[model samples]
Every structure is written in C-alpha cells, then in structure tokens.
Target: MGVDIGGTKILAAVVTPQGEILAREKRATVAEEGPEAVISRLIGAIEAALSLAGTEPARLAAIGIAVAGMALPGEGVVAFSPNLRGWRDVPLRDIVARQLGVSTFLINDASAAALGEHCYGAGRGVNNLVYVTVGTGIGGGVIIDGKLYCGACGVAGEVGHMTIDVDGPRCNCGNFGCLEALASGTAVAREAKRHVAEGAETCLPQLVGGELEMITAETVFQAAQKGDPLALEIIAQAASYLGIGLANLVNLFNPELIIVGGGLAHMGNMLLSPALRVIRERAFEVPAQAVRLVTAQLGGSSGVLGAVAFALQQEAEVRP
Candidate 1:
C-alpha cells in the first residue's frame, strides 16, 4: 500500500510488486481540521484502496507514506509541514502503523517521487539524476550513484529553499529570494497579481472576471499562450529563475538527467524551453553537455508509486 499526503488531498493506492497500480482512492485532506481528522481521512483512503483491490489489511506487506514536509523517518514523525496547517512533530507513521496493524514507513514526498522515477519512470536505468517538482512550491529529490541521498538530517532535497537572490521576496521558509519564491507556481501567480495590481495592460483582470483573488499560475499561462505581453513577461522571468536554479543543480550534482515534474510541468515546453535555453547559456559546458532534461513520465502518480518503492526498499533492507 502507498499513500501520498498532500496539502489538499490524500491519495492511496494498492500497487503490485512490479510497480503497477491495482487500485486507488482519493479524499480531501481537510488539513485545517487538524491532525486527527487528517489521519482519519488518510486511514479511510487506505481502507478504500484496499477494499477496491479486494485485499485484506493483514495480507498487505507494508504501507509507505509520502508526506510533503520534513519527515523524521527514524522517529516516525513529521517534524513540520508548511502546507498542512497545524502539523508539528506529528507521529504520523506510528499512528498509522498502530491503527492499521501494518508496518509503515515515512518519506519526504519529493524523495519518494525521485525513487519512483528512478525505479519506474523517467530516471529508470539512470545512475545519477535530480528530480525537481515545481508546484505550489518547489521541492527536489537527489539520486547519486543510483541511491537516494537524504543528507545527514533527512531534509536533503530542499532545492526550493536554495537562495537565488539574497534580496528577493521573502519565502515562507523565512528565506529571501529562494528559487521557490521566485520560480514556483505560487511565485508566478504572485508576480502576475502584482502586475495586474499595477494596472499592467493585460487581459488577466478580465480573464479572472475582475477578481484578482482568482488569478492563478494557470491563468497566467493561459494568457501568455494568447500572447498577452504581461503574462509572457511574467512567465519569462519565472522561467529564467528556474533555469538558474536548475543550472546550479547541474553544476553541483553533474547528474546525467534532470526530471522536471509537478503541476507547473504541465506547461511542457512552454516552461521548459526557456529554462533550457538559460541552462545552456549559464551552466558549465561539460556538465551541461552531458545532462539531458526531461519531463517526469509518472505525473501525479509519482508520489504513491514512490511510497510503494520506499516500502519495498525497506523490506529489502530488513531482510536478513
């Protein structure tokens, strides 16, 4: 069993040993309702997935959870989650394990996704790779020598928090000018809103039906697709920042591949082309020439699939 706990949704799946999903279930996270409520929902989703797969809890090998935060895998605690309101030092893994009577393991969502991609998606057969997910915020998973590196603190893949500009806008992590604060979907929408607020001559106001609050990164992309000058400018700026961030990763890791995924990845070449251009222009020639950037093949399924991969990896490590 594999569960992905996001800010707004809980997705559970029954995955085969061969990395195929047999059944899946999804439920609202309702994170605002507090930890107990969110835990209940996660359990419910797991049960629903099990039922759909016609498998009993006792028959399952283990359950792996992918959480969007700093998860202390050794302690079974989710130390903190920016997206999940009110979560602090929560013993999520133990709680789920006790309730379901199944061995449970916790992994950072991005790390799990990286494992998933390496095992079954874009990074398959690649020895070294970096997976960057750009969504509401940015996150990353690093693979070195074909192994996932969680750093000394298990918070290793926090590529989003990398300081891009020391004097740029403040990020939720209290950092100024982080790559995430500049290039994430949230950042894109924020910049677009600023432009609209300044009375930039764009159709964004009309597109959102005069409600600035409804403006989103997707809206900006839509307008940019239609040649809206302001929208294009916003996307270009964000893409440039993303390129710089990725270039930094390339220089640091010198990975053979970089898999770009997340909600923002749906923009495809519209987002990647500009970023690639910047990477080529700025990154070191040797690493830049050796690296190939590609979109993630697993899409939204990456998290749950990654959870399964984590569970399987744990099982292997414990054997003998």
Candidate 2:
C-alpha cells in the first residue's frame, strides 16, 4: 500500500512488488479543513483502494506515505508542511500504522518520487540522477550511487529552495528568489496574472473569460499554444529560471540524467527545450554534455509508486 498526500489531492494505491498498480483511489485534500480532516481523507482513500483491490490491510506487506513537507522518516513525523497550514510535528506514520494495524513509513513526496523514478521509471539502470517535480511548487530528490541521499537529517533534497535570483519574488518557504518561486506552476500563473493586470496585449484575460482569478498556469499554456506573445514571454522567463536551477544541479551532482516531472512537464518541449538550452549554456562543458534531461514516465502516479518502492525497500532492510 502507498499513499501520496499533496496540497490538493490524496492518492492511495495498491501496488505489486514489481511496481505495477493494482488499484488506486484519489480524494481532494481540502487542506483548509485542517490536518485532522486531511488525515481522515487520506485514511479513507487508502481504505477505498484496499477495498477496490479486494485486499485487507493485514494482507499488505507494508504501507508507505509520501508527504508534501519536511518529513523525518526516521522519527515518522512530519516536521513541517507548507501545503497544510497547521501540520507540524505530526506523527503520521504512527497514526496510520495504528489505524490500519500495519507497518507504515513516512517519506518526503519528492524524495519518494525520486526513488520511484530510480527504481522503475526514467532513472532505471542509472546509478545517479535527480527527480524534480514542477507543479504548484517545485520539489526535488537526489539519488547518488543508486541510493537515495536523504542527507544527515533526512531532509536533504530541496532543490527548489535554491536561491537563483537574490531579488526575486518571495517563496512559500519565506525565502527570496527560490527556483520554485520563479519557475513553478504557481509562479507561472502569478506571472500571467501580473501581465494581464498591467494590461499586457495578450489574450490571457479573454481565455479566462475576463475573470482574472480564474487564470491558471494551464490557461497560460493554452494561450502560449496559440502564439500569444505575452504568454510565450512568461513561459520563456520561467523556463529560463528552471534551466538555471538545473544547471546548478548539473554542476553540483554531475548526474547522468535529470527527470523533470509534474504538471509543468506536460508542457513538453515548450518547457524543457528552452531549459536544456539554458543548462547547456550555463553549466560546465563536460557535465552539461554528459547529462541527459528527460520527462518523468510515471505521470501522476509517481509519488504513490515511490511510496510503494520505499515500503518494499524498508521491509527488505528489516527482514530476518
């Protein structure tokens, strides 16, 4: 069993040892309802998936939870989560374990996605790689020498928080000029709305039927697809920032590949092509030449699949 708890949705799945999902369930996060309500929804999703698969909780080997926050898997606690306003020091693993009467483990959502990609997706057979998800916010995970490097304290892979522009917009983490603040889906929407507010000569406002608040990153992408100059400019700027961040990662990790995933990945060449150009221009010749950047193969299920991988790995580590 595996569960991915994100800001807007909870995904739970019953996956086979070979990384194939047998059944899955999804629920809206409705985080504004608070942590307790969110946890209740998460549990409900898991039970729904189990029922769909016709399997009992006790019949599962183990359960892994991918949380969108600073999760300390060693302590089974969610240290902090920007997505859920009131989640702090929440012992989620223990609560789920007790509720379901099964072993449960906690992992950072992006970190679990990295593990999933490494074991079953684009990073398969690659010893070193990075998995970056560009959605409501940017999140990342690093795999070094075939092992997930969670750092000394298990909160290591925060590639999005890396400050690229010293004077850029404020990030959700309360920092300035983070990659996420500049290049994520939220960033894209914010940039689009700002342009529309300034009366930019674009069809963005019309795309959202003059409701500026209804403008989203997808709306911007749609306008860009129609050759809207302002929309194209916004996407270009965001992709450039993303490329700079990826270049920094290339120079730092020198990994063989970087798997770009999440909602923005759907933009395909429009997002990656420009970012690749930036990476090649900014990174050192050897590292940039040696790296291959690609989109994630697993789509929306990556986090849950990663949780499944983590559960299997953890179970193996404790076997007699």
For all candidates, what are the clash counts?
Answer: 0, 0
Per-residue accuracy of model 1 over 1-320 as CA lDDT, tens digit each: 99999999999999987889999999999989988899999999999999999998899888999998889877889999998988999999989999999999999999999999999999999999999999999999999998889888777989999999999999989989999999999999999999888888999998989999999999999999899999999998998999999999999999999999999898888888889888889999999889898999999899999989988888788773
lDDT of 2: 0.94
TM-score of each model, in listed order: 0.98, 0.97
Candidate 2 lDDT, 45-75, residue by residue in tens? 9999999999999899999999999999899
Residue pairs with backbone overlap in model 2: none
Reference-based lDDT, residue 186, model 1:
93
TM-score attained by model 2? 0.97
Each prediction's Cα lDDT score?
0.92, 0.94
Which regions of candidate 2 are displaced past 4 Å?
A: none
Worst 10 residues of 1 by lDDT: 311-320
Off by over 4 Å in 1: none
Query: Among all windows of ten consecutive residues in candidate 2, which has the lowest summed lDDT?
Result: 311-320
TM-score of 1: 0.98
